[model samples]
Target: MKGITLLAVSVFSTAFLSFTPLNKKYIIIDAGHGGSDAGAVYGQFSEKDISLNIAKEIHKINKSQDKYEVILTRDADISSSLPDRTILINNLNPEMVISLHVNKSPEKETPKHGFEVFIQNSEGSKKLADKISKKFSAQTIVERNLHILRETKAPAVLVELGFINNTQDRNYMTSEKGQKEIAQKFVEIINEY
Candidate 1:
């Protein structure tokens, strides 16, 4: 009887260890465009590069935290199709997804600036966007039918960090300090989730 009980306990322990704990929340940080798809571009600044940097920064910061598991769609400069990204997101079934990007206005050096948070029609998506926008003191929270937002199974928000064409917006987004601050904001927000 003792031998049988010990064997059963060992099997249960092994099975529990093999599965992910329910207490930890999984979050996906999607770097918008990459490689051939350089999203919004202005001078030397590319949206793909900026978004990737921010995503990596967030992941790095989250590594120290025990309650959350942060994942990135692409860690390098490679183009990933919308469908592929969506599939990954759906498979992970994360608690939330944040897609990072830099925006560009049609006009040269356009004054349009500041961050914009785009969400899907779902209530959870809207709530997530509201939390992020409030953190940045952002005014624009638009409902968009973007591929990433529409296709992802989890609550997701697409954030346009800043306008690349605007001088102030461009400078802030490209600088290391700005990126760190942006990344820090996300870490803080994720803690709430």
Candidate 2:
């Protein structure tokens, strides 16, 4: 009886371990700009800093989902070349890639505020871009020809969260509440996919 009970326990434990959700689905989050490349700047805010903060927030949120494994192309304030970023993504072979950035519109005085998602010039990429754009329409504008999207081996998109030159955009992006909301919304989008 004792032997049979031990065997049953072992079998149950093995099954549980095997079936546990470990978030094996890989995702690469590229934080655009770093080091000398401050990207767009508005007032006291730098586009590179905004992008990294938002990417890190997304990473933190996704860590709890147990269904996604998030990787960042540039985690710190160090610079990474465009080719290197592409190579890293190719090596990881993630299910999806999201490159975060801030937009700049010098010609437009009024706030050009909206989220923009870019994909490769292909059917698959367009479909993904459309879905993401539609979902984030209230906060985003859809775009294409982004380098990260074009170079990544996996299905990828570049998200221009908002324009740094716009006063309202700058304020919202730099705020803690706005960053959290943006990160949460992105997590929702990934979860849906």
Full-model lDDT for every candidate: 0.88, 0.79
The count of backbone overlaps in candidate 1 is: 0
User: Distance (Å) between predicted and true CA of 36, model 1?
Assistant: 0.7
Model 2 shows how many backbone clashes? 3
**Model 1 regions more than 4 Å off:** 1-23
lDDT of 1 by residue, 57-144 (tens): 9999999998889989899999777877776677667899999999888876356899999999998898899889899987699998
All candidates: CA RMSD in angstroms? 9.3, 11.4
lDDT of 2 by residue, 52-122 (tens): 99999999998889667788887899877786677667755677888898999876658677777776766
In order of appearance, the predictions have TM-scores of 0.88, 0.82
Among the numbered candidates, top lDDT falls to: 1
